[model samples]
Target: MSLVIDIHTHPAFFEAINADEERLHLRQTCLGLYKTGAAPLAHIFNQMKYAGIDRLGLLPLDLTTTHGVELVSNAEIHHLVSLAPEKFIGFASVDPRRKDAVEVLEYAFGELKLSGLKLHPAKQKFYPMDEGLDAVYACCLRHNKPILFHAGISLQPDAPSQYARPEHFEAVALRYPRLRMCLGHFGWPWVVETAALLLKYPNVYADTGLLYFDSAREFYQHVFTRTLGQHWVDRSLRHQVLFGSNNPRFEQIRMVEALHTLGWRASTLELVLGGNALEFLG
Candidate 1:
């Protein structure tokens, strides 16, 4: 199927080299496009092509100050989006802990006109229901933008991720009924919970971005079919589940095989391929 949109990705911004070579410099400046062969893995265009993904949902991680140090900034994300307007969709990341969290959202959406937001509760050191972020949600709601939340239980240990649970988002969903919310990685361990949210809420959606092979695939299949129901596949093929290649993580073909094995209809497969993103992004 022909693909025109991809709902998730992180295209590295061109980083500036510094003499320090310390953590600060390495984390902040050692990025952007590399002069390696054709397109650099961090480059949006190249990453898109390498994964057979076209347009992308660009997520810049800026929260989790300590943990999300390598997280990209809204400024860099906006620049990349502007560089190739036809190939990318921008989503801003704001540290909900910052007093200027709402202001950050303003700059990204109100000023840059970005279409979405990436909220990482772990990196931000807050819960999805953190009162500090009420205004941030309000700002996105006021602007009518969607939010791609890095949700579900944490897979890593000693990781400072507090808002990985899918249930944490229920209040946000109930509060902002019109705000389009997508669970990155389909809420993983909480697929059943995430599936329930999708069933209960109109504004909720999921993406097939980073799920890998073997056991992970089987677990996802079981939940998608067992919990979401056999008919769930038919229902979500078009717009509910989106396709994403979490770069530097999983290959495109690997995700493709898993999605195809579900035996989805041609239209639904086409939607998961890219149609869903186009509808949401375009």
Candidate 2:
């Protein structure tokens, strides 16, 4: 098998949170994750070994301004990466609405050595095309860091779906053609719109972190085969698709199995699994 990478994972439930109350707070804030347990960091490594995932992108969510909390701090993510640098890729999150958002990003990219940025428009209650975020976008462009966005529906109780619609990102893509951005979860149920962005902008990408209903295989079949054409990924956007499990909400092992069962060419599978992610992270 080619090197597999799960590009969307929230490490909020790791053992770093020693207190039970803190863990409960994290679970409540991250909504729709009622059954996931806080486990030791080694548990993630074991899961990766079983799932054939060679590496993982550790994404933290900074909701300081809106939620008055950080799901997992950049410093925490940096600590995790320091423990296992070869297996973990860290991405920093900042409340773009903050006045010093650009400065925070610069420190994350330059000092913390985080690879990219992760943002959630719905949870943060901000529009993707808002002029307020131009500085954050410019900072990312200057540092050559990719931004991974939660572009579809969000499960947070206070999260508004209106903020995450795929079309809202069009302006960002058009304005910053040099900045690389990914709409995570394939932007479903707006998969077609997400695919349109992928087809139109070389700088835009999407990840297969979608597992909203049924089994992973069933959901993926419905989205990829029925919604988008069967060959759309391999033929039209092979290099732009990244495999993401959105772990704990879903399982990396099951998603990997589901993607392999889709009947895509071996080369296409390789790209979606890891090759495309490498290019996106560049």
Candidate 3:
């Protein structure tokens, strides 16, 4: 089996939230998650074991400027990675709208030793092409870090989907051709546009984190087979697609099983499930 890596996961609910009230508040306000209670570390390990996931790319959302909260702080991610450095790949989050955003990213990369950067244009309320973010983008490029952008729909209240459209990232891609980036959730509902970007830019990629309606298998069939054409990934974008479960919102096991049902070739599955992520992270 190829090394399996889940490239999209929010670990805020797993051993990150301390107080029940805090967890509840985050669930309601920041995360839009109804699932109550914090999951112990063991629960996540068990889930990974059952799902055949070798590592998790833990993502944090720094919504301090827009929502006055850090969905999961950089420090907390560092702590979680510290607990099991071999099992977790920590990504840093910074509010790009802040004047100190570049500085914060510097600390995250230099001091915390995070692997990459995760940003949410919809939740952060910033345009991907905004000049204000030039410094932040430069910082990531300077550190040779890839970025995972929250593309497409957002479950959080007040997070508009318009800001995360796949087209909005073209300019950034054009400017920083060397900086690798993944459009999270496959830019669902605009899957074609996402595919276009992936085709046009070598540095651009997408992840299979979308689960909007119905069973995972059904949804993936609709998106990957009917909507995007059955052989699109296997034929064209195998090297650019990464396996992402968007866990905490959806179960990793379900997404993994659903992806397997897509009828892709073994080589294609190897790329999507792990090989592609390894390249993206580099």
TM-score of each: 0.81, 0.97, 0.97
Cα deviation of 262 in candidate 3 (Å)? 1.2
lDDT string for model 1 (1-282, tens) is 686466766554333211233533443333322221223325545545665766777787774454555357787777777777777788888877777778888888888888888887754557887777789888888888888887764433333545677888899889888888888777776777787887788787878664544543574576666656766757743466777655434454456556766757878888888777766553
Against the reference, the lDDT scores of all candidates come to 0.67, 0.90, 0.91
Candidate 2 per-residue lDDT over residues 1-282, each given as its tens digit: 677889999887887653567656666556657766777878889999999999999998888898777778899899989989999999999999887788889999999999999999998999999999999999998999999999889876888889999999999999999999999999988999999999999999999999989998898898988889999998989999999989878767989999988879999999999999999999
Candidate 1 residues lying further than 4 Å off, grouped into runs, are 13-47, 64-70, 155-162, 212-223, 226-228, 236-238
Which of the two candidates, 1 or 2, achieves a greater lDDT against the reference?
A: 2
Selected candidate, larger lDDT, 1 vs 3: 3
Higher-ranked by TM-score: 1 or 2? 2
* Clashing residue pairs found in predicted model 3: none
Candidate 2: misplaced stretches above 4 Å?
17-20
Residue 115 error, candidate 1, Å: 2.0
Q: Give Cα distance to truth, residue 196, candidate 2, Å.
A: 0.8
